[model samples]
Target: MKIAVIGAGSWGTALSTVLADNNHDVVLWTRREEQAREINEERSNYKYLPGFTVPESIRATDSFAECVENTHVILLVVPTKAIRETVQRLLPFIGEDTTLIHASKGIEPGTSKRISEMIEEELGDKKVQSIVVLSGPSHAEEVCKRKPTTVTVSSETEEAAERVQELFMNEQFRVYTNHDLIGVEIGGALKNIIALGIGMNDGLGYGDNAKAALMTRGLAEIARLGVKLGANPLTFKGLSGLGDLIVTCTSQHSRNWRAGFKLGTGYELEDVLEEMGMVVEGVRTTKAVHELAKRLQVDMPITEALYDVLFNGKKPPEAAKQLMGRVRKNEEELASLFLGTGDSDRS
Candidate 1:
């Protein structure tokens, strides 16, 4: 299969390697002509994936028409904020039979739409075979090294999900198919918020006890929002849910966690983003989830606390203090809220 990966970031490059390794013809698209030349001539994307050699078989280009022409699949890996414009630019090049897949994890702030939703809205009457989401615990750094990694792909149809699974599956990269697109997307997007909070906790010198608490409770908050949005509760326990949460919250490679760590250590949000030099998705996701939770009446305290620290003038320590002082309830009672078995008053 000929695949056009519409982004040249670390994740896009790593995935292009995977597709090339699978013996599929891969074209990687970047907005910068210089970056394309570097990938073609120097075989390195040092700005994003330092010290990693890009596969010789993966061709890079700046032309969307050249990238998407004759391609069977178009994988969207750009940032959430760039999704709309990217789709609009690439729509003219997409084929009627093309399979659309997105690996970006984020919710648009005011719209609260997932990456797939944004793509569909941008697509407008242009019909595609499928809109699939590729998400899980896989990180670009580890993937670039061909380390063991697992991720989930979901779509509205089983055949579409299985087709994506076959396209990317390999010895080092395992792909699983899930029918619950809503849960997978929600889990993938919201996990970054928890990772930011966990990063802040670590930055503040809090120990493992606090980290464990935040992770556990943070998952509950995720499940709450996901279920309210029509996701299956069991999906939250799967790869795209708790699995993604655990990896992002604990890993140093996570930009969200790193950004939160900087914030916890007393750096301003703007400074943290400028220093990272990459999109720390959790900052934007925090604002989106904060608004979604409020509109839906879902109680996501961790999201709210992180939002206050990130957007409001609240300091990290003050947010921590507020989180620790909240009136606590039984864990199972909270679990029941998402399980759809709890009393209405509990919600």
Candidate 2:
């Protein structure tokens, strides 16, 4: 198989290594010519994956035409904000029969579109075979080390999903197929918000009891919004939902959690972002989910609180206080909302 990976970030490079290990011819695309030269000559991506070796078999390129020429699959791993521009630039290079798979996670802020939706809208009249999403708890750092990592591939077409499952599966990496595309994407995207909240809690010197409460309630919030958007209620219990939430909130590898930890410790948002030097997706996602929840009349208290902290100059301590002081409600009643069988009242 010939595969073109559309980003050279940590996740993109990690996935390219996987494809090369599977003996597939892989071409990695980056905007910087210097990065491409380094990957092809020095065989290292020092800026993103320091100390990690780029497979000699996986070539690197800055030209879209060179990257996608005769490729069987185009795996998009760019940030959600760049999806539209990246698709537009790569549209002419995409083969008619090529499969389109995206590993990016995040909802668009104003448009509230998923990454797959943004790609399809940009493709317009271009005839592509399939649009699939790869998402779950797997982090790029662990994946690069060939650690045991399991993720879900989802698409409306069962055949497409199964084909992707076969393409990425290996002894070190496990792949599962799910028919619930919406649930998988939503679960994968929204979990970052909860991870931010939990990171803030930890930064504030809170214990495991608080972290457990936030994670459990965060799963409920994700399911509630997902069900309202036509996703399967049971999908939230799968790898993309609870599994992803747990990993993102608890692991130090999570950029969102790290970003939140900084915020909780009294670092300004701009300074933190500049210091991290990477995209902390949860900040952008909090804004999008906050707007979407309001438009859909879904109650997402945690998202709202995080939005205030990220955008409205609200202090993290105050946000935590507000979340803790919200009107109490029955846990079963909240679960009912996840099934789409109850009123929207948060109380």
Candidate 3:
């Protein structure tokens, strides 16, 4: 099958390499003309995936028409903030039969809408036939080198999701299918926020116990917001949810965690972001999750506390203290929205 990856960043390039390795005809489209040239010429993207050459089967193009036209699948790997803008630009070139899979994993800040929502909104009249979302714990740095990893492919239509399963799932890369788009998408988007909090805890010299607590509470908060938004609460335990949270929150490979670690160590948000030289989806995602919680009246303490640190000028260590010092309430009380906890409010 022919595939077009719409972004030229790390994940995009890595995915393009995988498709090319599978012997599929792949076209990687980039907004930057120089980056496009680098992919086809240098066979490597130094800014994103360093020291690895992209497969020769993958062609690079600066023109959307050259990328999307006649492709069987178009993978959207732009950052969360760039999703809508990027998809809008692809409209004139996207054919109806093309299946779109968004690898981006964050909600829109003001809209609180998932990337799929933005895709459908952008492709309004065109009404693309199939849409799937690909997400998991896999990071580009590892995935590019062909590390064994697993992820989920979800679509409203089972057939559409399975179509994606055929395109990319392999021995090294395992794919699971789910009909719950909301659950998977929500899991992917919100886990980054928790990873940021985990980084803060580590940077402040917190121990494994603290990190474990953050992961647990972060899962609860993620489930609360996800359920409030119509996702299956059980999905939180699946690959996109719990699996992603574990990898991002604990792995040194995570960019969000590294950024949070810097923030915890006294660097400003801007400085950390600049030093990282890549998109930190969690920072923007915090705003979106905060807005969603407010709009839905969902009580996500960890999310709320992290939001205060990121946007409200609250210190990261102070945020951790605030979380611990909050009026101890029953976990079952708030989780009542999703899991029917039999535990009492005796905390």
lDDT on C-alpha atoms for all candidate structures = 0.92, 0.91, 0.85
Q: 1-347 in candidate 2: lDDT tens per residue?
A: 89999999999999999889899999999999999999999999998889899989999999988998787799999999999999998777775788999999999999998888899999999978899999999899899999999999999899999998988999999999999999999999999999999999888887799899889888888988888788887889999999999899999999999999998899889999999999999989999999999999988888998999999999999998998898867898556765667763453
lDDT by residue for model 1 (127-155), tens: 88899999999889999999999999999
Could you tell me which residue pairs clash in candidate 2? none
Record all residue pairs in model 3 with backbone atoms less than 3 Å apart, i.e. clashing.
none
What TM value does model 3 have?
A: 0.95
The per-prediction tally of clashing pairs is: 0, 0, 0
Q: At residue 115, what lDDT does model 3 achieve?
A: 92
Sliding window of 10 residues with minimal summed lDDT for model 1: 338-347
Error of 1 at 272 (Å): 0.4
- Give the candidate order by descending TM-score: 1, 2, 3
lDDT score for candidate 3 against the true structure: 0.85
Q: What is the alpha-carbon RMSD of candidate 3 to the true structure?
A: 2.2
lDDT of 3 at 70: 80
Model 1 quality (TM-score): 0.97
Better of 1 and 3 by lDDT: 1
